[model samples]
Target: MTRVAVVGCGSIGTRHIGNLLSLGVSDIIALDPDSGRRDCIHQQFGVKTCEDEEMVWNYRPDVVLITTPPKLHLELAISAARHGCHFFVEKPLSDRVEGQDELVEICQSRSLITMVGCNMRFHFGPSNVKRLVSEGVIGRPISASLDAGQYMPDWHPDQDYRKRYSAQSRLGGGVILDGIHELDYARWLFGEVAEIFCHGGKLSRLEIDVEDSANILMIFKTGISAMVHIDYIQRFYSRSCKVIGEEGTISWDIHGALKFFTAKTGKWEVVEPPAKYTINDMYVEEMRHFLSCVEQDEATISGVEDASKVTRMALAARKSMLNREKVLL
Candidate 1:
């Protein structure tokens, strides 16, 4: 057993708990300030529940997961690292770029295993694209584009979307940060970005102060040009990416199939991959990677240092949107 404690019961946090349990990790503990959320988890998952972050840490858990609001991530992570516990943190680090250096320094000194919650990397569709791009199947990828969006209210029909974390800027809950999936995958496929130009605003709904829509253009250091579009208002849930290369192009629906297109064929060609591959269990896989490192004192598949790059990109995008100009990375 990993003897893990989950430090939030929100949508992503609960999903992590459920996914961990599904992975045969049953010795789980949950911590949440929301009493009803914690009680519900205790009754349903048959796990111990703590009232706050401190008690959960005081128990000396083998592993700690920080799934709380972005503002509190660094504080709780530093606290857990001080107690000699490995951690898994959800994306964006913090709403502001403050305290990250201290957190990163402490984790490095403690040699703790840390993984960011960027599930798109675990998706077979994108993973296949990455492989193809690396294997010269598409030659050298020169440009990429991603279109990802969904209606916020439809995210969880049972809850009020207005009160959710994604609707709050103070929580680092805008589409740019919340929809960081595309940005992470881009960096994973095309390397670091050199600059970013973004346009965003609260145009669609009156329910939230945060930007519900965003259009971001990225210039990669490799001279690769990429464009990303994100929004909270959409007719249907959609995630798609297109990578253009020297000899060909790689494209996919992210939910359906991945295709490779060559100039000779003048159309998209199917790249066969295992149908059994799935991303639904990515959270569990990420958890297992973290716990195994915790047990063996090894490095995790994704480290905090790598995660820092994505956070920097998100923060730079925010600055670009604020300044109404492109910001160099």
Candidate 2:
């Protein structure tokens, strides 16, 4: 059995733990400073729990899931790499770019199988969009727009919104990083971004210290222009994207099937995912893929380098917002 350690028992950490258990990984341990969270993990999953990072690492786990906040990811990943343990880190890489390049180099030099949790890529909606764009179904994709928003308070009704990392600046909480799924999948579809122009701030009356909304425009090296909008003020949760091409347009959202509009067909066509598909299925698939990479010593779809690239893009967007100018990437 592969020994695994989950570094944090937050919401995302719990989700990953559940997936790992479902995938038959028996020897699992959870590490968190919160005794309540640790006890919850132990009681709910019957997994071992540790309050100290060194204690968790001493377990000699083959793999570590760094599901802590964006600010703590780098230190945990470096420690795991030093232990020759494979890593599966959650998204945005970090709140800042400092030390990430070195972190990636260390992981690569160690020949570690590292994966970043950008599970949106595993979703059928974005997966289908990537396929359609690559297959010329949209006929030379030129531009796109993506939007995602939700009420911050509703994120975890049981917890105070202000106390969570998403509402605090030092913890790397903000709409841009919190809803980074939009920026990540946008780049996945369009390719590397060359330049970006952005305008955003705490436009909403949200009581959080971080910005509540942001609008970013990116020009990709592939010559595609994309716009991204994220916010924590939307009363209802919503997410969608629209890709425009020379001959047609493709649009998709969380609750709806893929819809394509073409001048050639003079009508709209719908493409639905498998009937059994669910949102949680994406995380399960992501975990399974990561485990396969760890066992086979293979590379993952979203590796360290990919995470660094997206982190840079997210940081650039924040910079553009501050400088009120376009940033060249």
Candidate 3:
């Protein structure tokens, strides 16, 4: 019975609470400033709720899940680390990297288990792409393209799009930061980025202050180059990736199949997800992995130190977009 405290009650927070319950971890305390959100989660899951952060510290949960907006992530995580609590923070570690080094130091000093929620790494399609690339199925990788886009309004039909954190600049809302899965997995597949150039901004009339689209080019240290396009203006949700190598190519579609083409064979092979796969399955598995790491006192797949690198990459992209010049990492 690992005690847990979830620090936000938005959609992601609600999903995590439900998943934690489904995984048989009953000791949960949900903290949210919104009374409506607190009441709703309590009614839905019967978990304890509180509006005060101090109350959560009093609960002395073994782990903390910081699902708040990006700007608030590092501050909350630092506090959790100071409390000697292992923590899981959502992606793009922070809107900026100002205090990340300190947070990493605190966690390292305490030996706390930390994980950043790059849940796409757990998704079947991306996971298989990673495995296939590592297995040399695509031969020596040379270049790749990654794309992800969806209408901002379609994200949550029940809520106003303008009210979401993704629509606010101060809250670290933008297609690049919000949809950083591409950059993360790009590094995972290829290698460290040597330089980056991005071109994008709020080209849509979505009533948001942040960039709604981005076209990023990355030069990897391993001599592999990749292009990534992310946008919040697509009428339909679309996510896919293609990797071209010396001998073949591989493609992955979130909604469809993973296809591999071999130059010698002249045939395309396909792989599909299990019959009962759902998007939420990845989130559940992500939480399960975090909890297992907590129990075993083992290092997580995406710890704070590794996530900080990605945050730096994201911030560099923003600098590139603002200055209209390529940034060297």
Off by over 4 Å in 3: none
What C-alpha lDDT do the candidate models reach, one value each? Answer: 0.83, 0.91, 0.95
> Of the candidates numbered 1 and 2, which has the greater TM-score value?
2
Cα shift from native, residue 39, model 3 (Å): 0.5
> Tens-digit lDDT track for model 3 on 185-243?
89888879999999999999999999999999999999999999999999989999999
Model 2 scores worst on lDDT over the 10 consecutive residues at: 69-78
lDDT of 2 by residue, 85-181 (tens): 9999998788888989888899989999999888988888888889888888869898999999999999899989888988899888888888788
* Top TM-score model: 3
Task: Tell how far residue 179 is off in model 2, in angstroms.
Answer: 1.6
Give the TM-score comparing model 3 with the true structure, all chains together: 0.99
User: Model 1: per-residue lDDT, tens digit, 213-304?
Assistant: 88999999989999999999987998999988888988888567789988777887887657576556566666666667777888865677
Poorest stretch of ten by lDDT in candidate 1: 277-286
